[model samples]
Target: MPDFKRGRSFLRGAPAACLILFLAACSGGQPSAPETAAGPTAASTTAAGAPAVPSASGAAPPSSAVPGASSSTRPALSKEAQMETDRLLIRAAKANDPVQVRKLIAAGGDVNAKDDIQDSAFLYAGAEGFNEVLKLTIAAGADVKATNRYGGTALIPASEHGHVETVKILIAAGVPVNHVNNLGWTAMQEAILLNDGGPRQRETVRLLLEAGANPDIRDPQGRTALQNAERLGFTEIAALIRG
Candidate 1:
């Protein structure tokens, strides 16, 4: 077989099915960002760190998650309650129901709760191209940069799934486009690896390059974005960057 790794690479990041698995494996892996007081300022908390809140695009403003029965004096959650809450939040995200999602979060459903497979609401929303859900999660303080077990971040998932809007949201939220995962793959690398070169991918590349992602930046093996695009026959992308 020809060496596909160099040029037209296939996505090696976590698969859609495996997303949940990845999140579960690394649930609550990082310290959530310190909570901020209510305000119009665009700051939200998540496991990875703080990212700015997305501007309301006519979508309902995100309702704050109410501190649930688990107050500062409350004990830890029982297994069943935790599972139920997880199910509810995941369903809300999948259904694209921001109100229900906020309710779940207010109830103490982890904004970044991972399923059995380690998929969090943010990951699922990004992967499914649910822009609204992704925004709501971000506003509710979801971790924008949390990496999955496969070393996939929300940016990786959004790019892989061809969710341009989600990708933009992630970028606006300050996700590092050139950020590399355990596999030595950046978000741009993942886009090329997945053979995704639609307008979204092009925009993603443009965003990364403009944001200081050196197209000349090489991976562990010294492969550049141009090299990958050229090898994959992504002439448009190569041309865009070469310009």
Candidate 2:
């Protein structure tokens, strides 16, 4: 006959041993910890097929990827293109076309750029009594003391032409009044020698005198302005110089 009591005790111990083995197998022979849910990864996708996660810092995309962003970025112009634009600006200035001049300047034309004759837009405008273009060049930062091909400031030619308003503008802009040109003639001398001593010339001479032009500056012919005036019978100008 079988040992019933012994068999029953063995079956009871079997249940406890089986339970320990099952726990060890599930944990790889170590105690198991609870697992939390994982967060979404960069490559994770949504049901609608869109990106489920943003960038690491969660910032917006680059400007280049946005619409109308390219319009704000202007590439630098090449040297040849800038030179051509500056040439056109000089032409417009010489033609006394303020509209074209403004357009060219807004297109990155240089106001101080010199052409083959060493004449910049600023110099040409002032020398030709183009007050509108001259003011534009001035506001655009033209060098006030810049010289022309004859090494003369704009005031010299303006005075020679009896552009009284232009002379006043140049003087107020701080052009050197006693600046002598390559011909060794100051603005006052050019006004007296080059132009007929009329009402405009007299006014130009008077303006120069008031602006502190030196009457003692002799010409290349070694003649003072006053002596030249007396010889030329500019009695009023000579009288003004005497004062």
TM-score of each: 0.63, 0.69
TM-score of 1: 0.63
Flag regions of model 1 displaced more than 4 Å: 1-80
Name the best candidate (by TM-score).
2
How well is each residue in 88-186 modelled by candidate 1, as lDDT tens digits? 999898788888987887776776888777778887887778887788788777887776767778887677556677777888888767777788777
Model 2 RMSD, rounded to 1 decimal: 12.4
Give the lDDT of residue 233 in candidate 2. 94
Q: CA RMSD for every model?
A: 32.9, 12.4
